[model samples]
Target chain A: MDAEKKNYGKLFFSTFKLSACTFGGGFVIIPLMRKKFVEELHWIEEQEMLDLTAIAQSSPGAIAVNASILVGYHVAGVPGALVTVAGTVLPPLIIISIISFFYTAFRDNAIVNMAMTGMLAGVAAVICDVVITMAGGVLRQKRVLPVLVMLLSFAAVRFFNVNIILIILICGAIGAADTYLRARKGAGAK
Target chain B: MIYLELLWSFIQIGLFSIGGGYAAMPLIQRQVVDLHPWLTMTQFADIMAIAEMTPGPIAINSATFVGIQVGGLPGALVATIGCVLPSCVIVMTLAYVYYRFRGLTMVQGVLAGLRPAVIAMIASAGISLIILSFFGQRELPADLSGVQPIPVLIFCAALVILRKWKVNPIYVMAGAGLISIVVYSAF
Candidate 1:
């Protein structure tokens, strides 16, 4: 039990440091996680890390937090997951607190305003890269439904002004049906 | 009451933001910019800048920032928890059944379906931002007169550098900020 507590401490601190130090979150942090948990701490295996990452990516919410939850759970069960959640979340809470405290000051400062305005362009570029890359993946799949779904969903949100959440639900349903059909066909072919 | 509202809103974000941090952008934009009067498009852009430059998840950073604006430090905590709570429950359940669920078709199918939609959602958000940056707002003017030259220059250059040279985005973002500082100071 005492050893479990010690391990939980290790889990907390490792995730805390990762949350605090890493930038460009999501995929950027995955490799570092692999290095730390798989190579350094030996808490997770190589393939397991890959699987965990896959699960994290496929699940909802922030990949970083999802990945941390999976890692923590694997390392120390539900309690460990709790510790890691706290660790993963606290750093941003602290850092953003400082920024929030300076919210108006930052908003009012001319240089800060200009800088943020400039950064907005950079952020747009990055977002463009993401959309292009991800859309390219869907296109590469060579499936008509996913592509149709992509375009229609785009039109729905951008033009029709449909709610984003409603779109997600409908698309998820379609995707599940597509997968299930494909799976059934594959089994019949055997 | 405000805390509860923050929590519920972020909880919706958490539940819906599949695919990753960028996927959360549209969700956050909708809540803060469109649904509520909590933030303007420019301020939303500012939060995105900070969230992008900061450590941890963009969703977490966004939740904390917006929560602080609405509530305070405790609001930050509340929003952060709401942001992460779905992930916690979902991931724990996944871990519990990881072995049995490997290559599960239903789960795979739902995510597969979400892919194109997620891409579209992200693209929609990106285009709005591009408009916002180039025009200094999310909506475009009837004529070309309102275009901001600096953001246009920065946007094109950043895109080219990012695509052609494949530079680290953190450096690109910093470079963009620095260029703005220099240009503003010069003018």
Candidate 2:
């Protein structure tokens, strides 16, 4: 029981530190989560980590928060999930709240304004990097269907201005049908 | 009243803004800029930059920023809670069932389709950010007359440094910020 309590404490603090320190958002948090849980604690296997990441990405919400909840639950159930999420979100909440109090000062400052202008450009570049890396993963599959879905999704959003959730739902239905047909064909062959 | 409105709007943002942190940007823009008029386009861009620099998800950062802008400390708290509540509930529920049905064909199929769509959404978001950074938000028929060359140069340089040299994003952002401070202050 004592050991379990200690484990929970460790889980809470580690998640807090990771969320507080890591930047560039969701994708960047994955490797750090892996390092802490899989490598440092040895609580989860690398494969499980990968699976959790996949699930986190596929589900709604921030990937970082989703992954934390999944990992926390895997380790210690509901209480663990709650504790981990609190840790993960608290830092940002505190930081942003403090910034909130001084919003006018921060907004009106000339130096800050100039810095923001440059930071916006940098942020755009960082986002471009995210796009390339994500697209690279899809391209590596070397499959026609995934490529087609990717392009169609882009066009739907960029040109048609379709809601993203609607696109996700349509693509999901198509994927389900495709998989079901493939399964049936394989069974027939057997 | 404003607090309740903030909460409800963020709940929608948390629930419907699927994919990842960046995916939430459009919904956020629509809600805060278009629907509410709480923030202007330039202010929204600044918030986006600040959110990127800060730790945690962009969704949370933007929520907090917008909340403060609209309602202050209490508003920030309420908005963030609203933003994160859905994830907490949904993820917990899914976590309970996920491992057991890991092999469900429907689940696999949904994921197969969702993955590509998520990537495309991120790409689209990136393209929009690029446009916004280069040309200040001047509606569909953007006033190209307001285009600033310095930001464009910085953006190109940052992209090259990131892609070719593979520098950390933090460093790139910091360098850009420093350059802007110097140039803008000097002139």
Candidate 3:
């Protein structure tokens, strides 16, 4: 029993570490999640893992958190989910808190300011990289309609100051409509 | 009152926030700058800039920054908890039920559709950040001429190199911080 408990602890932390290191969020973390939880730890099987990602995205939360909970629960039930959420959330909370306390002082400091300015531009570049990667994915699927919706929503909010909730709802509505049409077509064929 | 406000703001952020840190940016801007007026656009942008350099989700850092801006330490605590609460509750519930229906066609189709949209949403957020990084609310910079391009170049080069070499982002962030301290001091 002790040994079993130890393995669960190990799984919990490993999932946490993988979650911690992931950048660009969610999908980017999928590979890491798979490597640690599926390939390395054998905590979940392949299909179940895909199931978790789907649910995580569709649900109203951070993908990483949802994924972690599902995987942790799969491995060790409720206790596992709690542990995983803690491990995932704790580090970021602590680190960000420390940062907030010092942020103002850091902002006025010239050298630090310059470095941060430069770094922010770098963030811009990184974002561009993600955009390119995502464009490729959407282009591959010939999902031009949704891609246009994303761009328009982004443009509307950023440039025109449209409400974000409205944008998401609009796109989500389009998605629903698309799904309905496809289902209806399938039904007719059958 | 402050703590409650902070909690409510975060609860809203947590519940509506899907995708990731960037997804929450516009809404956070609305709350911090427009609704609460706790932080200016410049300050919030600065916080996001720093958050990007740091090693965590952008939303958490934004919460901490806004929290401190509003009501100091306690405010920060309330906000962080609020931001995390929805995800914690919903995900745990989903986990309990997720096992029952592991794979179904409608589920698969819905996900297949959401995938492109998720990518779209994230990509758009990235683009928005890029614009914000370059230009603020009041006026757009005429050009990138005055900007110190070297550091920016080095950072981009480092990201691609690190990713290709599979070096951890923590190390990259640390290395970037070191370079800034050294060069900025020298200059």
Candidate 3's C-alpha runs over 4 A off are A1-16, A19-29, B104-128, B135-138, B141-187
Pairs in steric clash, model 1:
none
The residue-by-residue lDDT of candidate 1 on B66-143, one tens digit each, is: 988898888888888999889999889988889565655588789989989999999999999999998876787889
State how far residue B108 of model 3 sits from its true place (Å).
Answer: 5.7
Among all candidates shown, the one with the greatest TM-score? 1
- Model 2: lDDT of residue B141: 38
> How would you order the candidates by lDDT, starting with the best?
1, 2, 3
lDDT at position B125, candidate 2: 69
Superior candidate under DockQ, 1 versus 2: 1
The reply for model 1, stretches above 4 Å from the true place, is none
Sorting all predicted structures by TM-score, with the top scorer first, yields 1, 2, 3
Q: Please give, as one word, the docking class of candidate 3.
A: acceptable
Which candidate has the highest DockQ of all?
A: 1
Q: Model 3 chain A — which ten-residue stretch has the worst lDDT? A: A117-126
Q: Model 1: chain B TM-score vs. truth?
A: 0.96
Instruction: Report residue B185 deviation for candidate 3 (angstroms).
Output: 7.3
Model 1 CA lDDT for position B130:
94
